[model samples]
Target: MPNDHHNAPQTGLSYYGLSLLSYLRESHPDLADDADFIRTRAQAAAEAYSCIIRSGGSRIEAAEEADTVLYRGLHFSLYGTLANVIRSEFADIIPEEDAREAALILLPQAREVARSYELADDFAATPQYALLYTELTGTVQILLDNGIQ
Candidate 1:
């Protein structure tokens, strides 16, 4: 073995984090702008991803592990944060209850998308993953734009 690991393309936490941030920026700028919150969660995800990769896990495995860490309690933490942001940012237009409801609804879908991405090949480069990301982001954008149904 000629230190082949070094030749491996970067395909773990960094890629996942950037992809996540990009999607959030596009679909949920409020969430994306929460640097302290996002960075804290991303750090935890990166740790999980790094641990899995260090243990000789495949990229998919590492991503799955990272997602698990990242989304642990998404309904509570992520949803609550989003709800707060929506409530405060759009207080005049969107009702607090609607913001809460939207956050709750979006979280499960977000988790599903994360799971789908973990199962896809080539990380974010695969068409399947790209499609999932696009669909989820679109859904988020729509919910934010129109409020919960």
Candidate 2:
């Protein structure tokens, strides 16, 4: 730590974080392409592994990067239970399909419906955000596999 009257703390942003944002930006069209929105989002996300591979980053790293942003974006207040589950089992996994699956099982039958409410009206509404949410969704699957859901 450097403390000087003339020098303030240095400033910088994470390239990985920026890359996560970039990956998120890529999801816009995918969601907007759906007729109902849910299917569109799911499709876009289902194919995220392929997309990230072509986006100049490994799918695992890309997914992890995206997840990192999500863990921060929602202020760690959302998906807490599901997140714990993911970490418990597939903490080493990339996007975490297990978690995503778990969330699906709970959604439409429970009150854990934050994506449609907290994010946009649907996936088509916010492309980048939707993509990020998808990553989070996969993390939920990881949790489900871990018996979190």
Candidate 3:
């Protein structure tokens, strides 16, 4: 049989990354609108992938556990960063109530986007890995430029 995956381009993100970005931008414009928020969340997604691959070992249980732990860790990290940014940037400008409401509106959507990324295997040594990282961050940048996020 031919190597179906071999034809995959080495210098671009996998379809999964692109699709997730589109989903986040189209489904949750609020998260997409905040560049910092988007970047932080994208970093979380990338970190999750790294953790999954690093700690997965040869066991399925390990991979699953790593996924769970890293997902939660990165999620919390994103929230922590978000809080600090809001305090420094939005506290005096935007009313607390409005900021809270905006967060509520965007949090679930951001979580959904963050949760969509998963890794089945490690590709870190390959150009695809570079592409994945580039794509995730680039997606946010693209959205930012478009004023979508």
Candidate 4:
């Protein structure tokens, strides 16, 4: 009986949820490490701070807050994964710390550039959006090349 270990509840955490929780844990280590805290309080802090049921802000404001949370969280996760991959890929030539530091520096700027992209007047055109998209891609390309070189 003491050695049996088959009754544990499974928590099939999704990629997005895990990323959100990872960010919350990194930003607020003092918070309790539990599903209840993460789902209600920590999640609200990361994903609902601007749209609390009693906050009384406009719907647009709440939507913006949600967008901010989702975008930033995705960016954080993207950087984290990229750094890990770069470090592993260039293990012989690049130190893990250096690769991670480079990623940390570039990710925010890349995210800003990405968010700046917007559609042009024509339905099929996205000149400004394409420019920003290329800029972000070039930034990442530089990071990847330099990371390996």
Among these predictions, the greatest TM-score belongs to: 1
Candidate 3 lDDT over residue span 1-149, tens digit each: 87533222222433333433344444333333444444444455555556666765545654455345323322322232233344445576446655444444444443444454442233344455444444444443444355642
Per-residue lDDT tens digits of candidate 2, residues 15-40? 33333333332332122222333333
Judged by whole-model lDDT over C-alpha atoms, candidate 1 comes out at: 0.58
TM-score of each: 0.36, 0.21, 0.28, 0.31
Model 1 regions lying over 4 Å from their true place: 1-14, 26-28, 73-149
Instruction: Report the error of model 1 at residue 57, Å.
Output: 2.6
Misplaced by over 4 Å in model 2 are 1-104, 108-123
| Model 3 per-residue lDDT at 125 | 43
TM-score of 3: 0.28
Model 4: which ten-residue window has the lowest total lDDT? 3-12
TM-score, candidate number 1: 0.36
lDDT, model 1, position 34: 57
lDDT of 1 by residue, 22-69 (tens): 655444443655555556677888888899999999989988888877
RMSD of each: 15.0, 18.3, 16.6, 11.7
Which prediction has more favorable lDDT, 2 or 4?
4
Report residue 39 deviation for candidate 3 (angstroms).
Answer: 0.9
Can you write out model 4's per-residue Cα lDDT over 23-118, one digit (the tens) per residue? 544432222145554454335444574454349877677756754654342333435444554565556655776876655566565556546543
Top of the candidates by lDDT: 1
Query: In terms of TM-score, which candidate is stronger, 3 or 4?
Result: 4
Candidate 4 segments exceeding 4 Å error: 1-40, 43-76, 88-93, 112-138, 143-149
